[model samples]
Target: MKQFNQFAARPSAMSRALRKAFVYMTLAGTPALLSTAAYAQAVANDESTSATGVGAGDAALPTVTVNAAGESGQHLQTQSANGALGSRSVLDTPFSITSVTADDLADKQILKLGDVFSNDASVSDNSGGYSAWASYITIRGLPADWQNSFRIDGKPFLGYGITLPYDHFERIDLLKGSSGFMYGFGTPGGLVNYISKKPTDTPVRSVSVGYTSGNIWSEHVDLGGRFGNDQMFGYRLNATHDQGETFNEGYLRRNSVSLALDARLTRDLTWDFQSIWQNSNSDDQTPSIYTANYTGATLPSVISGGNRTLVGPGQHLNTNFQLYQTGLTYRINPDWKANLSYSHSSARRNRNEQTIYLKNAAGDYDNYRSDYLEAHTYDQWQAMVEGNARTGFLEHQLVFGASWQKQVNDYTVNSIYQLSGTGNIYAQNTNAYYSNTALRTYHAGEITQQALFASDTLKFSERWSVLAGLRYNQFEQNAFGIGGNRTSTYSKNATTPTVALMFKPEPNTTVYTSYVESLEQGGTPSLGQDNYGQQLKPLTSKQYEVGAKTSQQGWSATAALFRIERAAEYTLGNALVQDGQSIYQGLELGGAYRPAPQWQLGASLMLLDATYKKGSTFTGNRVAGAPKNMATAQIAYLVPQVAGLKLMADAKYTGNTMLRAANDIELSSYTLFNLGASYTTRLGKYDTTFRAAVNNLLDKRYWQYQYENYIKPGDPRTFSVSAKLDF
Candidate 1:
């Protein structure tokens, strides 16, 4: 274990506190003053450009306009953000990426982040349902790190025990494989970025009402417009409220509000501000089953006790979140630009979970309860410069920038845990033995990350190009005891690199190969291990990928082959250590085709082979929770006879999954079907739309594999309907 006797090498408590305050003040108050000065400079000069600014990029390229056609057509996105490298056409980018727009969410009536990409073969809902800790997903056969895998508006946020309303976001982007050179630190699995809706150039107003299975009801309002001379000021606002019983008999109430404002002081200078708030409460959530004690090769059947809500009274999860941000963009000239931004976000959570421990394959279990209270705050600042230059025989698009981020965490010392009672899966229970109570909280720890990155795309000809990027990162973690004294400190730094080569056979075709490396926070030893509570060194991951993409004649297709090798951590002879490696190799194929003017078809398939390599009992065994094959297909038909009516159906298939490192137990394969329809028409001078969907139409009972000791029940059949009006 590492020692913690270096207090003299660190800053004093008073200095640390002052530094934190100073950073807060700078982030909160500096943007406005800086923008004022830029505005004055802008007014003094009449030379300006009308081009929009690219966000969070070292190279300030022209912004790509996202329109309704991109949202409602073809089921394919043309452009996606490549981290600090800016946005590129999907066909031209060397990495695999995907985006889901607001229109898709509304059509499917999706409420949670996991459900947004349920049809993608490369993604899986690991938790199967909402969690008091966090909603989790698995990408490329690895679970994403909930603490560090999420971002908002190109900035970092703590993704613990909070769910933001989807209505506030215009789009969600996913970057697959190692992103160390683009993003400072993250898991190799992937990254999820939520792009909030911004102010519009035209006037807009809309209202919507929706209902889901079990009588859940929701109302939403959206408003946006510009005002002042030459429409120099713009604003967009969204508000929503929902309350009712869930399909599994759980009750929930949620409220959220988001606002975006921008001031175009001059054609070449722009400033923007954003604020978001959300509060949600859930009760009687469906309980997850613990299979550690069953010891049976054959687990309990899903139909035996699946879809059962074991939660009783006094059990609930409540969360609150808030975020504020400000940024300024200045177009130095047509060939170059500069950007600066700062943001702060916080989350608070209080939750109690009802847990069940399985005793046998016949559905008997012991009931228990667990409680948690935690708060997290984060602050980040970023600056970038981007430009285009040509020298002799090559043209270069260059970007360079730096960023700093810090997070402070507070948690209860020891959460309350109590045994409620014992019961059988076939029986029923609805009594509470304990009530929610307050617990003492203490400062847990803090983490800081800093990065400097640069990238260049060298275009040698219209048909060939190369991209090279590098990032230098430093990470620090400090642990504190309950008495407010620092117990341990860890600091590490590394430089990651990425390189790619591309070839374009045609205007709409691209073939590429890329290699990248990443570093991620390591795992801590669990109970019963010889080194329990000891933190390990950072783990490194590497990936190699080759892919091809094309879009032509109302159709698009993509194919990729990749391999990832990540360091593994497991118990060896009752001692936890980082050794060996987990290797994952996979092939992915996806496409969309508009066979005719009224018909659209889409499909995706993934084949993965994952294994653990080491001289141990787990050697050569299939990785736990990884599936070998996954497939999805969907079709939509626009009725030629009806003016604006569309019908759609989709199906997904998942192969058997390993449930333990020993590979002695496995989950059965399952397939699901969904159906939906939408109609658009004019209602009393208002453009109106009505949508309906039936998820899990076949009502199949299945178990979602999470890890070695936990399994969750798939949601039951559910129905949803909604209506929206635009004015």
Candidate 2:
């Protein structure tokens, strides 16, 4: 049952008369501006009465109180960091987390990180979108490892081939399975933090502008408040810029800056600071289709939708980034607390590429050309001491943490050349192979890690609880040859663990179970293997889970069932062995619902099997980008009488995936749809919003990633718009 065909092409006639005059002037002037502003606020009154009356007492009006802090507008979020047993709730976490907020990343206009994790169906998008270099993702079926699974407020940043900037984030959690006792050596597939954006005791000003179809264009700014006085300082700022051409024939540019600062220093102590900078550029750099040696060919046809250019406009990509952070929080009073943090990050890149390989089934191709120079650095330090106590029925929430991380990756690869193409996958003519080639570095590398951790959470009654964790790791690696000496070095040490159990029968339900472990960082042997660079040994993984969570009234939900296992290394004949075992089992579901008060709903689902149970020869197969059902859904409304209009729709589905691991090629199954609208009011006193969208919406031409004989495509129909202001 694999059938798809729909691209009847329509939208032009001046784009259907400008989308029917912008939806009939926004549904006919939004109920006449909500009935003339509800009849001028029903005969305005502005009450005033006691100027000196009974008792002539005017001294009783001297109490003014205003207290409001941050993050509200909850689109489902309830604390985070469950693996380290820190931050809690989500019905007292046991596992499986997903937060995403900042108003759900500006109502899903998210620009990357796979657009807010594609609404989480256990995430999967191994760089098939927004890649001007790298982004790769995959969870619940491995992959992930952008420098040890990324994080920001919880430290560790500069995730490998970078591309981070989610407009100064303020939420984005996602922690699904095995976080090596809360991050040690990673990749059992899960973890992503990013929470910054603080410093707000009040005031903030905003601005935004955007456009997208292929002409891109964007601008953004945000600033925040409080300074001196009894306020004791605070600040926040975010800036951005984006530029042009990219719905295929490639071209992009970006810039960013962020800053945050805060200080209180006396009552309970506090201090925080942050900084960021980014830069990017790209031009003609798309290519990533390998076809590991064509074989049973015949699968090339599907390239409708413009912007073809198979790489040659001289291809280029560039990136630069930086970050610095600091933190300190001390309470040490009602239940104790002490924390410390530090972070440093860096990234750099320069590349030129043109891959493509498929030399059969008539789509004749071949063009290799490669070049790259990269650098990454990350450093982290953390200290924690937390406590809570109660002994009547046994209650304790304790944490003891210690962390130190260091990462350095300096890579260089230059000139691979195989150009002199034979292209033709349906009319290809990249300006007759635009030229310019001169590069020279040949190979180099480096890697490192260090860790130590601990945690606890217990509570004996009021619906039981328990959590435990541990970590200890040390790893190092290096490889540099091509004359620069040092052909390899590897070091290792390990320990990881986690445990959880919880039950609450009703204050908004919860039931859970967990066990975890993970560790990774091993690899060498390349250049036709046979102990080419050797150095391997460091991989361990395991997970087991069961979960449930719920929230009532405004709805929230979560579910899980998991199993993971690993240790699969290959090459028995040339001897790079680990002698098999890989498994993944799953079922996950996610939720949110509002039902009324202007409806809202969200959903997620994933199935997954990911086998290769124990193999010498692909035993049970299946596992290559692992996919076995995935789903997502979303809906939003609000317009109950038009005040601040809203509307939205979303969908995504994926299934049937497998491309190698001897599963005999697969990849087919797709679905996508999107639609949106937004509006808010006020223009004179400031506060305005406007947005529009229409993505993919029935213009299907699938394929969203399948490596090992490549495939990437996905993303066609597009259109976008935006506006925002608040003073």
Candidate 3:
């Protein structure tokens, strides 16, 4: 039987199976799309609602209409895409999840992914702020890997040193815990999926202008519509330009464009195409410190406001990013469908960075500079089929799919990295630049992955159900030296599985317990380490969770108790190694309530205990950068007398974090507050909205740190204002 299994798993056999599955789905469709019914014609635009459960809609899957209170800031009441399992209402999913819509982001004036979940207690911003090298976050006390944790429309994307264009997406979804069975190989921390905006059924035109601190200004334009005699063609276009000085005394200029187009080839078939382009240039970045240098000593004094960039006089960075995707969807029948898609993503970066090494508590430091040109590209192809069926007394919703992805990394062979000058964080430097001569680019690394997945949700009764999923993955990683010699190679195959049992005690209320396993890429040594560039073996993780959810007309709430265990990596004797296990156990609570029509309230809290279970050097130590407690509260009020005015206040608190595995130093906990107001009214023939906000209202001065040795100053108080018009 074992020999038969190996023979059946060959490429040709798998190809035949895939073809048979596709044919089966095509034959089983209802053939109702050919009918001239109103429902059939409107099906193309009725995909699922945004994560906020209202307004914008997801373009990748079928959607349902969800009514929402105007600008109430209520989220988590709708369905969201769950990888191979298709889309399901949040209340029915066994895992922890959160969805934020474009409306909420625009209302809050958020442009950075690091701040996307500022109000969520289970998440923490690890990139330090907009000035950090890249944007990243920690979910449930585990750091998310950039290469595997981010997806755009269900396709993998490489985000090493770049930030995605937030304006191009209609909604963002976060799935917490191990999701290997759902999304192939990934970090055990969680997953972040971006749902791109699609053409709207109704004509939409909008323009906006905004201003931020330091004389920075921005302009954006959005247009969408459907055309043709049969209204079979739809298009959506967005363009943005930003130029201004940063609050940290730096200058930035950026431009981005996105276009989405769809065509109905037949009554039941649709084709979608999307493309995005972005370019950015920035100068005088905030200086970051190597906190590991001060391991057992008192930390340096916090640098506040624009004074934090003492050695950033000549630092600069330039980046270009592009993405293209095309897909075909066949809505066979109301209960069955099939999809095929391909996507390509690329990012190129050129930067001159300066790093500081702390010398004492008096703010003295040594500075170093480096120049580099690096590029990364990712390509993916996916195919899937989904349908519902009933056998005897049991009903099933099934999903099956296959996907392949390849990512390549390239870097300049002669990139420069060395000490340029010495300086103190308390004083400014006039020249901290280093010039590098361009050289030939070399292949640095490559990663390829293939996966086959299947899932089924079986209903035993109206109040009880079970969900089971499995995924088989084949992964390979290759690293090459400047001479084109293969330095290291790692390849492996594994199967991840997930199982959940759910019960509905009352309408709109669900309780569930789930278990899942994950496989993740191993760690590589950092630049200054003894065994730099060495790659470790693959890691595995497991998660157990129990959660409950409920939603009503005026309020919604979610609670989860979870425990996760995963392989841990740390430096020992100046060499990085993988040993022991990092265990995380936590409780999470989130809810939004409306006591009166004029008042809206929301809050969330998380308590976590993360530690290394057993290791020679770091046994029983708290995981670096993991905080024990986090909380957030927000309130918004709509004026009764004033026609269209709203006032809002939000607060976020982060607990003290460990700086290293030794637990010798700690970064103090901090709280931030924000206030904002918006007014909407009609002027002449156009609808207008004016907004103003103050972030970090108290000008709190503090230091933010992540992992073993990254530290930077938190953002200072800033003011912003914007006016938007819809005509």
Candidate 4:
């Protein structure tokens, strides 16, 4: 049998049975799915009530209350923090924020968080295109922690260290800058919030099948509806499966399921629940290449596009994640509300990896093998009370909240060994032999955090507003060494604040200035470093920003100038040190415009100057992994003659970036282009949509810079096509 066929048939009997059960369930639910479409059509065509109701003919119709839960038209605006801020406009917020809507995800064929930020000038990922396990992103020259910077519906999500499928999200919101006052202890870079698809009041049912380069195939189903006598109960479910080889010489398999429920228990109280499960595995995974070990040897030449250093075929990685969340909202009065929520998440991973360490200038290297089993669990709870009031000529929106989070991690390095073989990067050889010697001990740790926060937004006049917020946090961490012996305990307390002022000369324009601070946990030394396993003190950062936003007709524009300063840490000789400071100052410009009814344009530019202000030996050098400049622009046009037909083109550029604190090694800049086309039509009564896209149009070869001389290569040219059907 062919390799693909063999892979498809490799599942055990139990796995096959489970798959069959899922298929049977979907088939049995066909009636409900069909009814959903019928109900939606009926609601769209029902206008009799508008003409024959109690307020008929000459009388006015009752006011309708509409909730903006997700992005609608174009991806220009959002209300992601509405629950906490009382549904304020994005333009009115004193921070840089952007929303990627469902339409954008569909049009771009986004599958992961990295894909969502491919066109964002302010965002970059460290893993590049080599790793499919988890993504690490940076914003505004600061790194965001993979486990702490992700949120679901404005609440922290602990399942971020695993694959986050895009199929289950309605929209994603990005808040740039320090979020300490909002989310307590976290990275200063930014925060990413995923809004789940709510139960649809109008009913929804859709299925899509797709194929991408490297024989990857995917299938997804989404269903949502409102039921019950008064339609007070609603549900939304999503399922997806993907399998096959990736762009590289590796195999991937993934499955995910998500369900959400909404219930209106009383006239003034509502409850929501959500659950998600996901499993993913990759074989022959690509490993990150590090060049720091090549002390006196010349660096290897850049590998050609679409190629990578070969490793043992047995290397693999697997991850499983599960999450559950529940929340309740109670309206005390017309202007007062209370909210409470809780979430729990668990994740596990098994990895067997091999790294090639260069030994000479001729590409000779040693193969190092490592195996690990790890698990993580997180629990979080939050409660808040908010109200809107007016006194004399001043209007105020106030919020008071408290949150607590706990995280536990356990891991064991099963084995670490050196293989006896010398390999060349320019040649293919994977027959290296290795023997495992000693077994590593298991380690465990726990982190707990409690925080109290409050914010007030005062509208002093029709064209002026001021917002201020503060957060006080207490954090504690405990570590256990081999044999469950208590190793170390650390605790700290911090206070952070945010303040902003806004002025509007016109109804459609806003100018703002803001100051914010963030607090991050300390770093621990790696296994091979001197003082290994030692923890340093936490770090704090401050940011100052001034910006303006404006919207007129179908066009929107924003500009910002910002500066951030923070304490830094790095290895000096053999010991890790924190006696360094860094600063990043930059200007950002972005805009979206629909000049004509059928044409749309989006563009962004970022210019940064990142340097070490004070360091032992690398003072005044460029900060590692920070590019000097980045820009992206896209245009989409719809053919008026052929309805539902749209064509898009986009280009991205990244300037050179330093790979080390010394600024001796740098990754050259590169530019890439992408093209896409999508069409929507009706086949009889079934609505259908077709999409096709080509990434890296010119097959440009480039490298993504990382700290410590580690480099990741960009993906080569790839093609994808998908079709969706709506019942």
Q: List the global CA lDDT of all models.
A: 0.75, 0.68, 0.77, 0.73
Global local distance difference test of model 1:
0.75
In model 4, what is the error at residue 299, expressed in angstroms?
Answer: 4.4
Query: After best superposition, candidate 1 residue 342: deviation in angstroms?
Result: 0.9
The top-ranked prediction according to lDDT is: 3
Candidate 1 Cα misplacement greater than 4 A, ranges: 1-77, 303-308, 430-436, 524-536, 570-577, 615-617
TM-score of each: 0.87, 0.32, 0.89, 0.88
Prediction 3 TM-score vs. true: 0.89
Kindly give the number of clashing pairs for every candidate.
1, 1, 3, 0
lDDT tens digits by residue: candidate 1, 1-727: 0111232236345434434543443333232223344533353232222222323232222222222222243333456666667657667788887777888778778756667776688887665444553366778887777667888887777776677788888988778787777777787888888888899998879877777877567777899999999999999999987766677666777889999999999989999999899999877677667665666788776742223446666677888999999999999999998889999999888877777777888877887777768788989999888889999989988888999989887877777666788887666756465544766578877889999999898999998999998989999988788899998898989988989999989888889999888988776553334665455667899999999888877688889999999987654555656768888899989887777777778888889998988635677988777789999888877664444566778888888888766677789988889888776644435566667788888888888776455677777778887777788
- Which model, 1 or 2, shows the larger TM-score? 1
lDDT of 2 by residue, 1-727 (tens): 0110121133235434434544544443344234455632332221113423533243122221111011212233366654356776656778787777776576567656766777788887656434542566678766676666777776776564467767678888878777777767767778788887877888889877666777666667789998887999899999877766767756676788889998998889888898888888766755666666666634576664435556555666778888888888899898887888888888886666667776666677776655656677787777877778877877888877777766765655443344656576566646333333554444465566766677777778888878877778777877777677887687877878788888889767878888978887654342333674455767898899998887777677778899989876544444455657778999998877775667777788999888877677888887777788789887777655445666777887877677656665677778778777666664434556667777767878865663334565665777776666677
Error of 4 at 407 (Å): 1.2
- RMSD (Cα, Å) for all candidates, in order, is 14.4, 23.2, 14.5, 7.7
